[model samples]
Target chain A: MAETRQTELAHADSRESVTPLGPVRRSRDLRVYLVVLGGVMMLADLSFIFWVAPTDSILGDIQRVFYFHVPIAVMSFLAFFVVFVASIVYLVTRSPAWDRLAQASAEVGVVFVTLALITGVIWARPIWGVWWTWEPRLTTTLILWLIYVAYLMVRAYAANPNQGARYSAVVGIVGFVDVPIVYYSVIWWRSIHPSPVVGPLAQANALEGTMAAVLLFSFITFLILFVFLVAQRMALRETEDRLGGIKSAMRRRAESVF
Target chain B: MVLVWKDILLEVRSRELVISVLVFGLLVAVVFNFALDVTPQRVTAIAPGILWVAFAFAATMAMSRAFVREREQGGLEGLLLSPVSRDAIFLGKALTNLLFMLLVEMVLLPVFAVLFGFSAMSFTLIGTIVLATLGFSLVGTLFSAIAAQTRSREIMLPVLFFPVILPVIIGAVEASTRAIGGETTVGLGRWLPLLAVFDALFLVICPWVFSFVVEE
Candidate 1:
């Protein structure tokens, strides 16, 4: 255990030294990627949001919200699936790297989920004539939001660092399972929300050509941004771990000197 | 099975968890009476929800005691080190909790009925309560085990539990609503199957996940 600790300390120290001047060498490529990807999403959000979709009388121009809303919701679900997959991988391999990946993805999933909820409400206010309704889709989304928020809180307030990862990983796995149940329960319970768009092919064919292109482009744009966010967050987490190690080392050094 | 009996025996001797849950449940019923301003006609409609809320709240209190006592007496680690399977530990604890919750529910049912002027002796209502409580206790026990590891465990248990088990509560209350209102077929048709499904799912999943959460 002592030898392993020493090697871990040395590895972290060397990585820190190599990236001392820049914003941490580990995150450099990821940061550049995120900046570029974020720029692409912003452009897409501006262009297709107004230009692509036809407006309905009841919904007004607020149908534009679908461009940003649907993509974020889809990406959030995808991000959580990654968290679930990574959690299973971590449990099987007992690898800290997989745990970090799961944690990073969960954090990004929360961000996108929040954006989904906000944009959803924005769309609902005009379309449904209410800011919030206990409609099945809305209710399930709210529950999903609560679950992920609780996930974040569990990790934040956990007293024992080692136990935190394991406990939160289990939560990540179970929480992901709940997502599908939530989706289906809404349908099963029979609320006012519209049914899912069905198959990808049917969904694509339903949209106008330009609208389909724009929506697909926005989806790709958000996917890239999601990856970039995960990478950046993982790099920051690595830096925080290094700083924690350094603090422990400093404490040990002071104790030895005294 | 013998280990599960041992847990019941321990609880019978101590009476700490059972007494506390029973009293807490009664208090919740009393509070709901004044809060909801229950009239005779409305009582049947509201009784099912009140019963569940009281039971759920009291169960949260009871579950906090589930592992804390073991931890305080230094029994948990010793239990883990024993030859018994971990699932046995989970089963024992969960069964014990189920019994305690039922004991509380048994008392609360009559008191709530009398206070609100409703009948508690109906067979269908009894069946719905049994199914709902079983599902609640099963999931509650699992979450209690998970929360026992955390720092603010008492608060943590409910936070982790309520959202996960909301579907169970919904199914139970809906079923109980139908049963209490004398709509026997509707109660069994919709809620009973849901309750059974929830119970089955938790019983299978919780034991598999318990070992992971309980590891030090």
Candidate 2:
């Protein structure tokens, strides 16, 4: 209990230090709301995946990865879209909040993209008979991953924090623009990846009614997860900003004492 | 306009940028001869890819040096402090870089043809080169400025650049391959628009963001 109290004091102290830059007025209730909503959606998605969605006619149990895989892929794209919008806003307004949002979404997007790629590889193993192929979708996602990875690296290596934010905002905007080009370039060439299931060209009734419901549940769950993860990451960014402020303050104080 | 002319005149007087890029590009093509072990007959099939790889690398080399002259001469800050807008500086530098790259490419093309024996001098091939080079220089110049401020400026430029420009390279190679293979009009028809679109997007976006980058 004493240890817990000490930890709480440290947290409060850090939070206080962040106010010099204007406290990140993050809504605790909003975070709690997202976490609760995500938990509920996750439970519903798992239930549907196990109990409602039928086994694939061709691929059987292994094909179940699709229910989680496709939704996460969609969420990853959404996350990058957020990064693009946030980057633009940051550039226009020069607001640290938007930069924080952009950076947070990009980091979360990488995680989602990684999960999608792993699930994609697993799904490909039994079906495509290979662990990986340069399919159009796979290749585009890989490039997207690389661009954002470079974005993060630029931010990490920049000479100054402010300059890094400016540089990364530029990268974030440019990198997002490449996504559609990567997609179109690959699509124009050739693709071994499966065609869309819900588009105009999709097969009639490719998804059964129950399967559609489960997939929808998965998408909702993943969207909630995306929101929760981004908020959590944004909060961590605030804490970091606060700690940096506190460290510089302490250094200034030490110099004066000397 | 004045900035652009200044850059051009500076290059004209020194002749360093064009000469180095041209020699380096030609050397790369020659090296590809021994590296790939291409038989004369197979040159038509592989020449486009080799040419693009060489151009891409050569363009990167020239771009890494884009701001080094200004930085070395201690003129970057004076330019930034001048009444000219940041966009003008970017434009001036980009135009000069574009001219230098095209000069290198124009000379490299004949040399490449002589070396590879691949007849890569058609109208369609020229069109593809122009479009590809425009996009290359625009993106390269912007990244060159960004990388110049970093510790590992030379290395950072390529690492930050090549992946972003992969689509341009693919489009150029595919189009140039078809053009060299005698499908000139059809190949140009297919890929030229894609390259044009990429160039147009960067032409507008890079300058807008460049001011932000150079400011702080």
Candidate 3:
């Protein structure tokens, strides 16, 4: 029994030391991909906002909001969806990779959601004649933003690493469920925001010319950007984790010498 | 089931949660009186919303205690080790919290009526409060469980919970408004179904999610 206990402790220590190395390698590769992808998205967003869409369409100059607003909104929702899937993956597999992915996605989702809120206010000011309104979509989006921000807070303040990740995973999963309800509530209640333009039959029939082309390109560009951001953020997290491990090891070594 | 009852019995013996919630609810009702420019005519119109705000905030205080108490005593881990299903634990706590919140509401309703010169006997209004409280407590119980696992749990619970449960608040307030305005059938028609839907959705989802929140 004594020998078996000693072996188990040694095995656990060895596993802990080696685990960070795998994530570090994976993170480095992801950083390279993200940098390239983010660059492409930055350029695409610039072109769409400046050159592609007509400055004076029938929707008026307010149409400028569409370039930033739509893409950010799409990216935000996509980021949250990633959180949902990553959360499920984390819970089922108990893998740190999924946890890291969920955390990174949540952080990116917050950024996009913030942008979406800002662009929304700017759009609303010109179109609705107000900077802020208690309109359903606006309210729901604002609430969604708060939920993720709170998720971040929970993760940051958790005393233990495992505890933080697990808590945030549950929050991410619950918050994702709220998104569909928000969408549905906006539909159920009359709202100042326009109804979803991309319904089942209406989606194909709705987009015909340059509008379709620009929107599709913008979405793809944003999707790539989302992937890039998550990759970079995940890399940063891995580096932090490694630094944390190193600090603890150095502290232990110092204590031993003392 | 026995464990669930045990938690309720434990809470009953302590009585801390109930007393604090009732006192807080009464204070909120008093504040609403001055804040809303209370007059006999205007009082009836706004009374339901005021009552709900008091109950909801008070219930939040009560709900935070649900897990924080167990965590403080270091009893939650032991509870998890027991044979009770995780869902039973969730539902048990939620129902107890709901009952406590409703009890506070019951006391506050009479207090609100007396202060605002409104009637407490409206069955529809009472029903609205019941459904709304259930929905709020259900969602709150799940979130409190999640929040209790974090370091800054007490502070984080409301921040995470209130925003997510906005729909419930809206439905409740709207339904309460209809009932208070003396539009009985339409108000019941509108808010009751929404409250029921909210309750059903969270009832199914929160328990399934509770085990994941607590497992680690």
Worst 10 residues of 2 chain B by lDDT: B182-191
Per-model clash counts, in order, read 0, 0, 0
How would you encode candidate 1's per-residue C-alpha lDDT over A32-126 as one tens digit per residue?
97778688776866776686556534446766677788899989888888988988898778776687788899899989989999998897676
- Per-residue CA lDDT of model 2 for B1-216, tens digit only, reads 887788888888998878888888888877888888888878877899889998999899988887987888878998998999888899888888788888888888988888888776588889889899888888889888888886677777887788789889888988888888884445456578999999999999999989888985
- Candidate 3: clashing pairs of residues: none
- Model 3: per-residue Cα lDDT over B1-216, one tens digit each: 675677778878987778888888888988888888888777756777787788778978988988888998988898899898899888888988888788888888887888887777777778878888888888899889877777767789889888777767766766666666664445456557877877888888789878877885
- Using TM-score as the measure, which candidate wins? 2
Give the per-residue lDDT digits (tens) of candidate 3, residues A6-120. 6644544454452646767876777677778768777976777678766544447676677668888989988988999998899789888788899999999999999999998
Give the C-alpha miss distance for residue B37 in model 2, angstroms.
Answer: 3.6
Winner of 1 and 3 under lDDT: 3
TM-score of chain A of 2: 0.86
Residue A178 alpha-carbon offset, candidate 1, angstroms: 3.2
TM-score of 2: 0.89
- The segments of candidate 3 whose C-alpha lies over 4 angstroms from its true place after superposition are A1-34, A57-60, A183-208, A249-258
Give the DockQ-based CAPRI class for model 3.
medium
